[model samples]
Each structure stands twice: as structure tokens, then as C-alpha cells.
Target: MSGGIHADTAPKPVGSYPHARRVGDLLLLSGIGPRIPGSDAIPGNRYDADGRLLHYDIVAQCHSVFANVRAVLEASGARWQDLVDVTVYLTDMAADFAAYNAVWQEYFPDPATAPCRTTLGITALPTPIAIELKCIAATGAGARR
Candidate 1:
């Protein structure tokens, strides 16, 4: 727990990192990508016969990305509502902005409770991943695990 005190009571981390760490009342999480359930390959990076990116569907990717984020939160004993702020990094903002918004609305439910966010359009990402999300959250009440 070099970064902070871990709060996860579940199994050991799936990777080389801690599941979740507590800093005061806040819990900062690592970025999450849309990787397959039991596989490390991220979705949406495959190419079609035309050499086009498969699943060019940003909406679907957005959902999967957040769903992965939700999994991390759940595994760490936190919930979506606890998220205070988030940052999204994208490969092409102009093209996928709308789709991203649509999926974000579905997950947020209420705009009032939505966390502050920053979205960036970059030329590339580590794994052809269209999007990646990192978030911060608060642990209320009996916060210890």
C-alpha cells in the first residue's frame, strides 16, 4: 500500500497493483480499459477486412469502459455514486464525442450527480484502446475494510 492504505477485502489483485487504496476519505483508482472478462486484450482494437477499426462504435466502447470501472469500484467495496470525479482520454474526440455522451448519460442517470470530468482527444493510446477512464471516490462511514 505504498500509494495509500488499501480498503479492498476481496481476493488479491489481478495484476501488479493494489485493488484500491485509501487516502484520508478518498480512494483514487487506476485507469480502466475495456478488456475482456478473463483476457487482457482490450475490445474495439481489432480490424475488419477493410482495415477499419472494429466496433468503431464509440457508444459500445464507452459502456464497456465504464462497466470495467464499475467492476473495479465494486471489487473495492465502492459504488458508482461514490465517484467524485473522473478523467477520460480518447483517441478521437470529434468523431466519438456524441456516442460517448450517450453512453455517459446511461451510466450517470442524473446529471446533477455526475462527477467532474475532463475528456481529451489524442492521436493514439497504448493499445488502440479508444477510451480510458480514471476516477476518484470517497468512502463514507465505516470506511475501513
Candidate 2:
């Protein structure tokens, strides 16, 4: 029991993979970035014509990434509350974690209701944005998985 989920409102994936894959009752999302849908615009970074990163804003990037994640989850018939696990990648954890955590709280709210998360500091991401998110969500009985 498997399938792929895609949302036209979300940014197209950089690679040839679906936005998320459903296996059994779970939807596993690909790494989602802050890029706007239907365009190469990233919400928090200034980039040159050659795609060089000029400056970054973790707060704006976090919001856009979460919005993208929400779009994918909804497309898969899941909600933010259905998320059970999350993995976050940040290019500079030391410099960005505080701001990222702040925006994260706005989404998850209560600590008890928040999904389990593991955030990693990485050298870079597929794009110039500072943040990305990968999530696993539980699709209830009505979902096709």
C-alpha cells in the first residue's frame, strides 16, 4: 500500500521525487525548502543571478518551509497534528536555531502536542536557504494509504 503525494501550491521538488510517499498509514515527506511555488524565489535569502547566497533570514525561511510542509501534508490528507516525527536541517545551527525555534513554537504550540524532532546542522542544503524540513505524518483511516 504505497503512493505519492504532490501539491500544485507547493514548490516543485528539485529532484525527480514526489513531495511525499505514503506507505501503509504514514506519509514521509521529502526535504521541503523555503522556495516559493512556481518560481525560484526564496523567502529569506538574497541570491545573485548565478545563485550565490547573499544574506539569509532564518525566521522568514522557517515560516515558508512550514507553510510548504503544511501544503504537502494537506495534499496527502493529513494535518499538522498528524505529524509524528520531523527532521530539520540548518546550515548554521548556532546562528539560526534560536530564531528557528521561535517560529516553530508558533506552529506546534504546546510541547506535548508537538511532534518529536531532530534538528541537524549541515554544511549546506540543496538550495541557498538556511532551513529545510522533512516530516512523517500519520494518515488516519480515511486516507488512501
lDDT of 1 by residue, 1-145 (tens): 2363332332233457755576777778876666555665555566789866666557667877787777778876688888888999988898888888878888887877788888888898666678878788887775422
118 in model 2: Cα distance from truth in Å?
0.3
Candidate models: Cα lDDT each: 0.71, 0.88
Error of 1 at 129 (Å): 0.8
For 6-83, candidate 2 gives per-residue lDDT tens digits of 899899999999999988888899999999999978886877898777898889989999999999988887888888
Candidate 1 displacement at residue 130 in angstroms? 0.2
Model 2 / residue 65 / CA error / Å? 0.3
* Steric clashes per prediction: 0, 0
- Please identify model 1 stretches exceeding 4 Å from their true place: 1-16, 48-55, 142-145
How many Å off is the CA of 9 in candidate 2?
A: 1.0
Model 2: residue 129 alpha-carbon error in angstroms: 1.2
Best by lDDT: 2
Q: TM-score for every candidate vs. truth?
A: 0.78, 0.92
